[model samples]
Target: MDFFNDHKKLFSSALAFFLCLTLVICILPALDNQRVIQPLPNAKHLTAQETRGKLIYIREGCVACHTQQVRNIDMDQVFGSRPSLSADYALNKRMSFLQNTATLMGSERTGPDLTNIGARQPSKEWQFTHLYNPRAVVPASIMPSFKWMFIEKEQLGPNDIEVSVPDEFKKGVKGKIVASQDAKDLVAYLLSLKQVELPSNIPVREFLYKSEKKEAANSGKGGNLPDGAALYTANCVACHQASGEGLPGAFPPLKGSSVVLGDDLELYITIIMKGYNARVPEYGVMPPVGTTANFKPEEVAAIMNHERTSWGNNAKEVTAEEVKAIMDKIK
Candidate 1:
């Protein structure tokens, strides 16, 4: 009893010492060691306009609802070409010790991921309209309208950068909705969110779930066809939608599209080989679909064949030889 009483404080000190030693031995090294930072193969530093836009993006809390990550999981299939790497955000850094520093890889995804949004939707006009009134472009969108970033002008001057608000969206407003510099900057930032050519080391590997596996199986890839449906799902479904009826006023529908049903295979091939910027002031841009997805001639042929046959349209099926010829000619 006397020994216990005498050594009680010593025992408590020893226990505390061991706990602290455990932390030092186990936790400190993990916390202190910095992960190797490498730039992506095609990663570029932000331009001045993009930098300003990024600042605005941070200020507006756009990250609250949207995520900038494309996790390497089955659920993130529609996010980007490959899963996000730390190099993607390595260019983002603090200006000073006092200024705010943030990594915009948000926690939740109330809205769709914006990691590769620039590649998916590159329309400046659409971005402006969507920002001014999300419901104007997307009737079912739950996103709050950022109308405050715009002003109602009596009429757009020749020098003015106009926001193309459709007739249905302009319910009672007499003047035109013109985007302010802030809105433009914000859109600029959003457009800069595209992932560039990923480093060769980090290649995307497909992970098919049970339902997706069934869908792949039912897509009829058994014969000479190159799994066109699966290809479409991986590369085209996000923008064009599963129904082939794309988002109205944003992505054009392929269901009845003349381009998809046209007899001119060369034109179709050209569009796929070289990206299309509609520049119609409303419709979103289509990135070079085939090139972006790294699709080969056979894959292109398969995709074209599927597009021609499906969705109630009857058109001639494309062959790999024809696609290869077109691709070679274009090159």
Candidate 2:
């Protein structure tokens, strides 16, 4: 009995030492896990509205019906170059990326991958309409409507607005109808879900092209601004759109872009001539726009002039003759 009592103190001390050691090891790593979770250097946290929508997405049990990750064999190469990582969001500890992964312990895909669900369909109005009434956009959408997120249209600015927006939308909106702030935030999160490798290399240059040769060729065909704007609205607006905003990330925006208004007018001429189908890219490429293409050289010049000047952009005017000169090179 005396020996047993003496041994009890030693055993208790040993247990306490082991527990403290384990706590030290676990706590230290947890406090610093943010460093490991971040894939991008200095990646920012989700914006306020996106963070709110994330909560809504979780509360609605959307996770029960959808998956936010992709696998290599899933054949979603256009979704981007590869699958996602917890490090992609710096979210490894906040919630296990594995927890959000909805898959069949048995097997099922009742809903589509909501991984990059932001612009999976463009039009912000489409999201609102789909949420308010799914059957309106897709007769087959079985996902229940989230009418709770909507309200009737509200008045925007008093003096500047050309058209009255729905009570739901804010100024400078892009959707088909009205939109909620949460919708904008959710779209931001979705667009930010780009898991593709950031392109690190710039396109290699050969030689700069001068417009002098083309200008000499088009010596008599110079056209002005209004003609170009009219031509653009008539011919180019169907796909590229009236505002040049493009279809979000689906079609590239012409506003504030270098490639569209750049010095290489010849490159523009070739694409317009060929009509764009760059071999199975993510968003569908262009169909032929003229009789065999989108427009005549004069029309193309007018549209280019409109784009380079509109969207608060001020640049050199493109003339019909200039476009014709480039067209001749391509033909």
Q: In lDDT terms, which candidate is top?
A: 1
TM-score of each: 0.72, 0.43
Worst 10-residue lDDT window, candidate 2:
210-219
Q: What is the lDDT of candidate 2?
A: 0.52
Clashing pairs in 2: 125-175, 125-176, 153-166, 153-167, 154-167, 228-302, 289-293, 289-294, 290-293, 290-294
Best by TM-score: 1
Positional deviation of 233 in candidate 1, in angstroms? 5.9
Off by over 4 Å in 1: 1-35, 136-139, 153-160, 164-166, 175-177, 201-255, 277-287
Model 2 clash tally?
A: 10
Question: What does candidate 2's lDDT look like per residue over 1-331, in tens digits?
Answer: 5645787877887889988987898867865775555555544566666665665666667667666665444354323334555455554223355554222111234666655544233334445445655544444679886655544445443321122122232344443233455555554554444343433442222222313221212222353323655556544554456678654423456788675778777766666556565453223454344434236777677666667778877767677778878777777
- Give one digit per residue, the lDDT tens place, for model 1 in 1-331: 6657778877987899999998999777644532566566688888898889988887898989999998878778577877787678777777568774546899999999999988766667668878978876566789998989988889787756777665676777788777888998899889888888855677655544514343322233223656788788766765566778866655677888899999887889988767787787656566676775567888888778777778886777777878889899886
